[model samples]
Target: IKQLDSLKIDLSKTAPKKENLYFKNGVLYKKGILFAKGIEKGRVLDQFLKKINFKPKSVIFIDDKLKYLDEVEKFCKKLKIKFLGLRYGYLDKKVNNLQGFICDIQHKNLKKIFCFIQLNRNGYFQIVIYFKNNKLSMLIF
Candidate 1:
């Protein structure tokens, strides 16, 4: 919360605009950050659109979970909004301790770990990760 509070928008320097970008999540902020309770992931954006009275023609939805991404993509298609889905992956360029990060995620969240690791076999590469019981069981490709 402290980190987010520090990153809050500097409204004094910027002029009010009709279009605004927001980070939707489970926690609600008093400053009007969009919050979606329960397991409804896509409804946050739906309610946000209605709250602002804005109808967008196109929207790009990026997420780590394939299921949630598919849900949002379908909703956007139903609304006639252009949709682009991006599967987020985590890669380290200058770090050698990738496994440490994976272990941390598994222990901390006990939820979906969307980070995909690339493995090379016979000069061919593949993305692999296993998610079960709210934990990352394996990461190999």
Candidate 2:
């Protein structure tokens, strides 16, 4: 929530307090949102379903891992709920490309082109690149 606030994104109009967000069997919930940290995706979905008053006509589950997608797919099948599972890989590819770019820069001209390179606390790469004319280019991701 603090992170969102830092970016000027306000949720105060509908935001629940930290205290309102509770945990049940390792799953975190705040009103309708669920954060299934360190828990099986299928079990989390089941718990969420039980909490809702009305059954959903369809569910669309997207995850970076195929294992989690499979788990949710099986659960939806057992419940006779229409489900679509999407295995998201776009970010994975982007991260891979970024890593390759970092490696290429380091191997080719680290001292000449790079002013600074850092891996921040959030695991994001912060790079300061210098052009031939001493122009600056900063990349953060």
Candidate 3:
């Protein structure tokens, strides 16, 4: 906590108390949690394929990893290659570890729609992002 006070950086506006300060290896930490959270696995998958200049049917990259199958399905059908060892979990560990950033901040309380990590009748985590214009966006981490 002393380290964060010295660095002069806010961890997350929403989670100022819980995430305001973290000691990384007994050192100071001042990175925004939302900045990292927003780039989570699903989001990263979206960004990853977008970066490859591949747009689904327009282009496809075959891989043995199956967890990303959903991401590929967004723009393509399926590849002949088999997806063997793949895990479903956090993709952006660096940002995911940042657990207190404001993915959305509202001047006044507004309705937010969060997403769940797994497919269940009862959801796990909820995500809601609100902008300045009273508009709301949903994201799952």
Candidate 4:
């Protein structure tokens, strides 16, 4: 909350009255504010639209979890709202250390290993593994 508080601009004269912002609160509100149990349900979009009393031409839902993105995508498709799913990426020195871990695991367990890597898509490293007859067959993610 301190970080968010720092970003607030004192636009007292320039502020628009119709514009309102609501941050996620873990408590229930009985009056004006809309609350949700979680993001994965995709109900927040509906609540927001209802609160504004407007049907937008498009909606963008950003989430780090692929499962939540998938859920929101489904809802957006049903509502004919243009949707884009974005995976949040952490590009830190820690990611470089992950390369060594990947190599160590491959050397210890797998045979005929191959990896195809590309740059800067989401700044995330994901490993997808496939197994055939309880043996590791493919790894690509």
Candidate 5:
């Protein structure tokens, strides 16, 4: 947080319009003459949307608390606004959240390797492993 101190991002005393939205009383409106001030928390939509003055069908409240979500649900019902909950609820089925994969072969310190298995003219099966250090080893499997 200290690194961001030099950015000089100052919020004015009034916070200009559309900058920090104001939802005073039951009736909604902005404070400034232009759309540059005030903010819409429900959608974070643009000025074109605010100018249209259209009632929204749904509103998704995003908060880190379950109690806040419950309160938002009640508000949505009273305003005739559909509510969408974006939460990671308890899973009904078991899920595996894996990040990486393990190789089928078992070699740990190898940076580069080549494997070749071939049958010689004398009917002998020979397997060769060429390592990164230009070292070659032959094995019979």
Candidate 6:
């Protein structure tokens, strides 16, 4: 929301007049935008549809992953809602083409700082670290 505000984008006109902004469960609603975390996209869409009083005649869903798009498409079919699922692969292509590497000295430093570091064939890195509270955190980049 803050990022949208910074860009001077006004979404109020397209948003529902009442109850347009709120955070419930793992979903965040701000004007015309809806964002969900820690949940499947299809489930999130289902939740959103259930909350609305009217059923939409059609739904257009776009996702970078075909798995998610397929889930949503199946859900839409169950409801008999006209559906269009677009699979976007721009980010996937970019990530796959990326060249990620660490110098010998950098690798040594990372080994000292992290509990484990694994570099995958796609040049992505996964790191595991232990905190002072004995909590384990894993990060992928």
Among the numbered candidates, top TM-score falls to 6
Which 10 successive residues of model 1 have the least lDDT summed?
A: 119-128
Q: How are the candidates ranked when ordered by TM-score, highest leading?
A: 6, 2, 1, 4, 5, 3
lDDT of 1 at 87: 68
**Per-prediction tally of clashes:** 0, 0, 4, 0, 7, 0
Cα deviation at 87, candidate 3, in Å, is 1.5
| Candidate 5 Cα outliers beyond 4 Å, as residue runs | 1-19, 22-54, 88-141
Query: What RMSD does each model have against the real structure?
Result: 12.1, 7.3, 17.0, 14.3, 21.9, 8.7
RMSD of 3: 17.0
Candidate 6 residues lying further than 4 Å off, grouped into runs, are 1-12, 16-18, 21-24, 99-141
Alpha-carbon lDDT of model 3: 0.38
* Local distance difference test, candidate 2: 0.66
lDDT of each: 0.54, 0.66, 0.38, 0.54, 0.43, 0.64
Candidate 2: segments with Cα more than 4 A from true spot: 1-21, 95-141
Whole-model lDDT, candidate 1?
A: 0.54
Backbone clash total, candidate 2: 0
Worst 10 residues of 3 by lDDT: 32-41
- What digit string (tens of lDDT, one per residue) describes model 3 on residues 14-89? 3323333333222222343312231223344344345334333343333223534455444344433222334454
Q: Give the higher-TM-score candidate: 1 or 5.
A: 1
lDDT of 3 at 84: 33
Evaluate residue 115 in candidate 2 and report its C-alpha lDDT on the 0 to 100 scale. Answer: 65
Cα-based TM-score, every candidate = 0.44, 0.54, 0.22, 0.43, 0.28, 0.59
lDDT of 2 at 7: 88
| Alpha-carbon runs more than 4 Å astray in model 4 | 8-35, 91-141
| Residue pairs in candidate 1 whose N, alpha carbon or C atoms collide under 3 angstroms | none
Candidate 2 residue lDDT tens string, 19-128: 33455576776533557775788888787667643466778888777888999889889989899999878667555656556666556666666566553333444565
Q: What is the total number of backbone clashes in candidate 5? A: 7
